[model samples]
Target: MGGPEQQVFHPNANIVRKAHCSSMEQYRQMHARSLERPDEFWGEIAEQFHWEAPVKSNFFSYNFDINKGPISIKWMEEASTNICFNLLDVNIQKGLGDKVAFYWEGNDPEDYTRVTYKKLLEHVCKFANVLKSHGVEKGDRVAIYMPMVLELVVTMLACSRIGAVHSIVFGGFSADSLAERMHDCRAKILVTADGVWRGDKLLHLKEICDTALDKCSKIGHNVEKCIVVSHLTRLSNAHTQKTPGMKPPVHKTPFTPGRDLWWDDEMKGASNFCYPTWVDAEDPLFMLYTSGSTGKPKGVLHTTAGYLLYAATTFKYVFDYHPGDTYWCTADIGWITGHTYVVYGPLANGATSVMFEGTPFYPHNGRYWEVIEKYKINLFYTAPTAIRALMKFGDEPVKKFNMSSLRVLGSVGEPINPEAWLWYYRLVGQNKCSIVDTFWQTETGGHVLTPLPGCTPMKPGSATFPFFGVQPELLDENGKIIRGPGEGYLVFSKPWPGMMRTLFGNHDRFETTYFKKFPGYYCTGDGARRDEEGYLWVTGRMDDMLNVSGHLLSTAEVESALVEHPDVAEAAVVSHPHAVKGECLYCFITPNEGVHFSTTLVAELRKKVREKIGPFASPEVVQHAPGLPKTRSGKIMRRVLRKVALNDRDVGDTSTLADEGIVEALFSNRPPEASKLLKAC
Candidate 1:
């Protein structure tokens, strides 16, 4: 399937007026040098940070070819440094101590906090001491499950400060999911909050943690201590009387006398001058679990020096971030985007960052716009799913806010359709700000393929170019590399600094999953195409590709075509078994607000798909969906959709979904004929 190339959007003269890399020529030269002389290029970047002991030997070594040995990658092997120290102490020594490290926006717009670098250090150090007092030491695992608050960031830094590997579970995850992750990491201590507020609902986080801990105990993995942050309780206590239409104050939090310790109580007696624990560059910094194809989650492990250096460098160049720019990335600290961008990246560059603790639609559909206006945010990074969700409400919510302060906008998590990209550019960016559509994964710690805001010209639906030092190549099904303007599997010919070293506690699995597919290349597990201009457009995952009567069609391509229709807010496409065609496209579409779904609309959508990607790509079944099943982070749960489309009774793990009821609703709404087909099979 093919369509006309999208019109390219160049950087606005005003937007790139003060960019670090002003022209495409400069970016090309720098990227070429990064690949030609990696050691020199990376060494210079490494010097920007504070290293306890610099590398005495080779800067990096790798073995992507399994025939050589176990698949491995090591960067700055002979160096020693503390990621927290570089992110905090180094910046403080550079006279950024009084600068605002984080502008924390709470769930309620009225509640906010600004934390200076000096104050952040004090809090992180004190919390580090608290972890030490509870027997947490170097290499120990600490599980953090808390809401989006200043304390959560403090806990992450604290773990890094004392060389304890932290695993942050998203607050919205079910207790069983939390327990599975905690058990996988064999966490010794658990950090959580009393409760959290999402929109108008109050979720008891402590109760969830208690349940997770109980599940962990049953699995023979016991947490020695649980540190509880009384965030909501403190808010409730401060406001003596309840406000009209607000939930009642949360007064009591269940506690296990010996194992549970209040966060404030531990901080009161802890010292604020705990020294950083230096470790090898290759040492594990954090472990984040991501869903695997086999129904089990795999822990993607990242190291210290390489991960930090990559995050900082990419943050500086990708967003064209200036020194005093107030950057905001609307991602919870639980995800890799938050870990690299929100905490490590901007801070490492001494840039002011915004941390928000609620959904984009919470309080109102305009919450995100309000936060941007309130903070005068310069660089804003968010997901395409969120952008699409906000698009359903029309432009009124965003138009009311002053987005003139924005210089650069970014889209992550998934490939953005042209329609949503145009809406974000026309309304949110005001047609002046550049949109950098980044393409990477949890396995890759930072951006791999993305347009440089000030350098590469933007394409609405394409990632445009690879980041510095990323060598991207497309390969056919037989593993032979496809030269130019062809669609195939996307893979990297070489390793980047931010690439995950291995799966925690399972090195063999890591090798087999990523390296086994292409032998010498790192298989990205996604299909992509390079246009005539060399801009790469990522089609969805390989598994999402459908084969119909010898014709191959990408679900992302069809979904993008479906979303291009004005009435469709979002669309998810999955393949269903068909006796005649081998497989057929099954689409779940959510219409825009106030738009009625009917046969006319469905026919219009199918026509749009056929026009965009040819007749073979037309979806066989079109189901009206009130809402697509998404994770708390705004990623469409396509697996659940696939299961529901097939009318499978056992829809695997809906725990990570934002609303499990959406799955049930989808199943209930499945066409009667489709249900019959499943039963007949």
Candidate 2:
């Protein structure tokens, strides 16, 4: 993680209205079905999607009792079909050749583009050829380092079309991050662009790629070549050329290079595409790494059949997608949310999804609203952090849009505050839509716990219910499952189709990270509680579980209690070392405007947490601040806060931090060590 160079100013998003949902009863039947006769329920659901070869047995088998762990897994075990066939092969024959798969919205609202199934297939075909020309093959991993663009999507589908395994590294990742992933996968081909533009700034992606390739043992030797799209490959030369067709000699000279090939040239005469190679249903389609701090990024391998089945089913259910509807998930494809929802999920269901290539607020604060207006986007899915940021600007810019097309709203990446949830529900959704705050991870494939638009009643801050096949349980420390809504470790007591097979080449780590935590149960890295109403609310990661005098406490609970207060806009709580107690509680608070900050607000917040939860949950210290540190996805970087709070004095691994400047701005105190250390020590 880069230190001191990553913080960016963010504005809070306005959220209004509130999502209301009912009893967990009707959802219970589905759970009962998933448990008792899983084959019947899930097998029927899987039938809705296109499968090349139909299996005779509905479910081969399913089981997961806490003692057994992975409570249930339905294997259409005998079925053999490529996921690409489901997305591309079947759609063509139905004459949905012109069906729009992706509607792209760039930072510049004017730069709109659409890729139909026919066009997407052609690009995938051509790119598959390009990959083959460069020596890519089935099982030989390929690395794609590109931005949120059409070529990136094309590269992914191409990998699946040719049965090649792709490992996507998000464009914003540093060379060290990219190099680590490249070495882990030992990819044969590297797909990258020279550079990319984010709002007014240009990112030197190709330069970073070249630098990463130098250190990557796999790419340095095994990598055939790097495929560079002719983007402004460097920040320095971004504005050198006036426009693409302009008569600029120096720019034209480097537009296409000997080692770097232009996408325009690569697609010409590269066939309307070769036939998609069919493989075993279990054959890995791609390996999308998770957000790891260091070492090797967890190469979460997703296979074709199980992955497709889960994404398609969960996408349709969680968002309540209607045929011919426009869905927008403003996430980069490098992450799981982007991989499954942005691409595979919508495409499998033959729905149109908008792929945004820039920040929500770029050219103007109204960028997001403008896209919603222009696209008439029906279902808009984004992160909680983004919503909180937009809340700062109030409802002014959002009023500029005629967002009648928006029918459903979604929150992913992290648990959204009820206040921000209400804002999105009111201002953006206009009370007519459903705010389905979903919870799942890269390892889980699709949304495991979420509200299904018309099916489940949504609780403002709650993730609501488990997806069709998932069986969720809240467990206490002694390996006993907690029945009522109480804070504890979150466990998926069964198997999910989209679940990661292993942490590529590291089975032991996989077993240790997930399974070992709770024998027989797939320990979700998060801690959650089922409310009295049975609505599930996620606190944060398991490691985020704090110990106060040996009592397990979650930062989520305290933060949630703080946000429940009218004046408190946001909060981040972490453990600070105490001589007597192993770790004491400390919180950084952000108050809403028009509310004067003083000792009174801090006292009020502390009392709120104490009265609402318990006196033991009281914060030892509460400091009101302008803002708290967060990730790009909106998750509070409490780890950073913990280090500072404990008087470590060192600002740790700031590269992962969305606001590095906030570190210095927040921590005025100093530790007896060199400044800006990358480790916790």
Highest lDDT: which candidate?
A: 1
Cα-based lDDT for every prediction: 0.90, 0.74
User: Which residues of candidate 2, in runs, are more than 4 Å off?
Assistant: 1-26, 49-53, 56-58, 61-74, 218-221, 233-259, 291-295, 565-568, 591-601, 624-628, 631-635, 647-653, 656-659, 669-681
Writing each residue's lDDT as its tens digit, candidate 2 over 1-681 gives: 121112221111211122121234555776778777766776777776666667775554544333454433446766767677678767777788898888877656656679889888888888898888877788889899998888898889888888999899988777878888888888887898877667776567887887788788545554557787765433223333435554422333232254566676777867775877777667788898886644456887777777888898888767777776789998888888999999999888888888888787789888888888888898899988788767767788899889888878889988876777878887998766777889998888989888766556566777877877788888888879898868788898778678777678876677777777677778887999886767788988877777777777787767767777777667778776655556666788877767777778878988888876677778777766677776554457676787767555575456545556888767773322213221222
Among all windows of ten consecutive residues in candidate 1, which has the lowest summed lDDT? 237-246
Instruction: Report the Cα lDDT for residue 175, model 1.
Output: 96
Model 2 C-alpha RMSD vs. true structure (Å) is 6.6
TM-scores, all candidates, are 0.98, 0.87
Q: How close is candidate 1 to the true structure, as a TM-score?
A: 0.98
User: Which ten contiguous residues of candidate 2 have the minimum total lDDT?
Assistant: 3-12
Query: What does candidate 1's lDDT look like per residue over 403-464, in tens digits?
Result: 99999999999888888899988899999999999999989999999988777888888998
